[model samples]
Target: MFIPVEAPTAFQSFTLVMPAVAVGNVGQLAVDLIVSALNMQRVGYIHTDCLIPMIGSNPYATSAETAGELHTAAEVYMAAEMKLAVLQIRSPIIQSKSRKFRNLLVSWIKASEFSRTVVLSSSHGYQRDDQQLKGIPLRYLVTPALQVSGDTFKELGWIEMERTPPLPGLTDPSTEPRLSIPGGGITKGLFLDSCDAGLSLAVVLVFCSEGDNVPDAFTLVNSLNSWLHLVDNKGSQIWKIPTSWGLLFGSGIPPAIF
Candidate 1:
C-alpha cells in the first residue's frame, strides 16, 4: 500500500487521514510497507474488520461476515463522488485520544508472526499546537531497518536460504568471489531513494495545484515565490497579483474596474 501523500493544487493544504484495515494480501502488504518505511514502532491498532491473531481470532480462521462488514465501512468513507472521504474503522481494543497509536502498534508487532513491514508518510504542513512542542509528519513513522533488510534478502537470494554461508576459501572459488559473509552495500542507495520519494511527493503537490494552462507555469513560479516569501518573513506573506498603475491613474478608472 504505497499511499502517496499528496494533495492536488485545486484546494488549500488540509489534513489527510485513513483508517487502517485488513483487506487482504494487498491491504496487509501496504500496511506493512508503511510501517517498515517509517520505522513506526507502536502505532495504535484498529479492531480491523478482518480477523487476525492480534484481534483474538483463530489464526487460521476465515469469516466472510466479518470481512464484508469491514469492506462496506471503507467504501462509505471513500465514496467516489466525494473529493475526500473520512471513514472510521471499528476497533474495540482502542478508545482514547492521548493513547499514541504508534506505541500500541509496536507491541502488537512484537507479538505477531509477521516478520517484516514498512510505512511511509510525509510531515508537510504539519504543526503542533503547544508553543514548545512540534508536530511530526507521517514520514516519521516508517521502519527503515526492515525496508533495508528486505532489500538485502531480495538481492542476495537469502530469503529462502537453508542456512548461513561459510567464510570464503583462500583459493578463489571459481572465477567469481563467493558470497561475502557480510551482505553487499545497498544501504546508502536505499536511504537516498526513500528521501527522494518524499521530496518528489512534495513537488507533486505543487504541480497538481497548478492546472494545464500555458500561464500555469507563471502561476507555479509565483506560488513558489510566495512560499519562499512566507518563509523569509517567518510566516508573514501576501499573494502577488498582476496590476497596472496606469490603468487606474490614466483613465480616472472606476474603483470597481481597478
Candidate 2:
C-alpha cells in the first residue's frame, strides 16, 4: 500500500473515518456523502495489491477543469482545521489478504497517532431477528477508549449490536465471546482488532436490504453527525450531494427496450 503524502504529520491527532464494503454498499456510499459534504481534499491514497484495482474520475471534484482527475481504489481526504480525516475505500479486499490489510491499516493508524476512528458499515436486512427489527436499523459498538464519543449514542437511544449466542448443541470450541455480523464482510474483524489493540475505534452500522441503499447511507451519516457534529443540525445548512452521483449506476436501459 502507498501513503503518498506526509500523512503521519499532516493528520496527527485526526479522527479518521472509513467505510467497509459491506452489504448494500452502505458504508462506501455514506463515506461518499461525508467527503462531498465536507468538500474534503485528497492528500494521498492507499494502493494495495489486495484490493480489486479501480480507477474513476474524482467524485469530489467540483471544478470543470479538474473533473476528470483520477480517484484510486482508496483515497485519503482531510479537513485539517478540524483534525478530521477520511479514508474512502472504493474496492473490495481480497479474502486471502484481508487480515494483512487490516494489520497494515492498524499500524498506520497507530504510527500516525490518530486520536480516534469511526467505521461506517452495514449488515444484511434479512438476517435480523425480531428484536433487531423493532427499532431504527442502526446499531453501534465502541472500543473502551471511545466511551466518551459514545455519549451521544446513548442519548440517541441507539442499540449496541448483540453478540449471537451459540446454539445449545452447536457451540464453537473457542471461549471468547463471538460477534457475528452476517453479510458485513470484514467489519466485525476490523472493529474487534482495534478493540484488542486498544485503539479508540467506534463502529456504526445499519441493517439494510439490497436495493436503493441511498437512504441508509444518509441515516448512517446523520447518526455519525450526532456524535461528530460534522454539521450543525440547524436548518440553515443542507447536505449537498455530489454532482458525480448522477453517474453512480450509469445511464439506464432505453425505455423502448422494455
Candidate 3:
C-alpha cells in the first residue's frame, strides 16, 4: 500500500536508499541519518498491514510549530534533483506479512524503474564468523545486478561480507556456496528478491552488539556515504544529527538529588 504524494512518475530512473528492520535497529537509524543529511523532502508513505502499528511526531520536522506533527510507519523522502529516493521504515515488519511486503516493495521498485537500491542494515556482533571480527566494523553484499556499484567499492578495496556457513546438508545451487545473514531480518530476503527480479540492489551493513546504537548508526551512514557520495567531504562532519535526536533521551534530569 505505497501511496505517493509526488506521484510515481517522479521516481523513474532514481536511485534508492532502503533499509531493513535488523539487529540494533541500525538500518532504521541509518535511514534517519540519510534523511537528515540530505534534507530530503517527504514524498509519500506506505500504508500497509505488514508492519507494526506506529505513530509519532515527525522526526524530520525542523520548526517548533510543526515538530510534533503526526507521521506514519513508513515514509518516502526524495532528493528529486539528485534522482535519489529513500524509504525510511520506522516499525517492525509483521511476521506473517513480511513476504507480501517484500513482494510489493519489489514490484513498486520495478515499476518505478529505480537505477539502484542500497540497503543499510546490521547484524548481531556475536553472530559474526571469525573473519568479520577483523577490519572495519562494516561489510557489504553486492549482487550481480549491482556489479557497477560493487566495482566502485572493489576499487576502494572494501571487504565483501563473509558467506554464512552452510548447514551440514543444506544445498544451494551455487558451487561457490551461498551466503547467509543470521541476525538480519528482511535484509537477506529483500536483497535476494530484488536480485532475482533483476533489480539492482546492494546491502551495506555492520556487525554490532545490542544497546545504544546511535553511534553505530552514524558510522554506518558514513560508510555508506563513502560509496554513495551522498555527503560533502569538505566539511569536518559527514552529516549532522537531526533536531529530533536532541529529544531522543529527553531533557536532563534535575541535579537536586545529587
Best TM-score goes to which candidate? Answer: 2
TM-score preference between candidates 1 and 3, better one: 3
Superior candidate under TM-score, 2 versus 3: 2
Cα misplacement distance, residue 39 of candidate 2 (Å): 0.8
Per-model TM against the reference: 0.22, 0.91, 0.89
lDDT of 2 by residue, 1-258 (tens): 547665444667899999988999999998988888788888889878879999988787789877889888998888888889999998889999999889888888888889999999999988876567788889998898775733677798789997764552345758544587888888988898998899999899999988898999999998989878887678654467887778778787789978
Question: Model 3 over residues 26-101: C-alpha lDDT tens digits?
Answer: 8888888888888998889988889998999989878988787788899889998889999999889998998999
Range of the 10 consecutive residues with the lowest summed lDDT in candidate 3:
168-177
Going through the candidates in the order shown, the clash numbers are 36, 0, 0
lDDT scores of the candidates, listed in order: 0.25, 0.85, 0.84
Sum up the clashes in candidate 1.
Answer: 36
Candidate 1 at 232: error in angstroms?
45
Between prediction 1 and prediction 2, the one with superior lDDT is 2
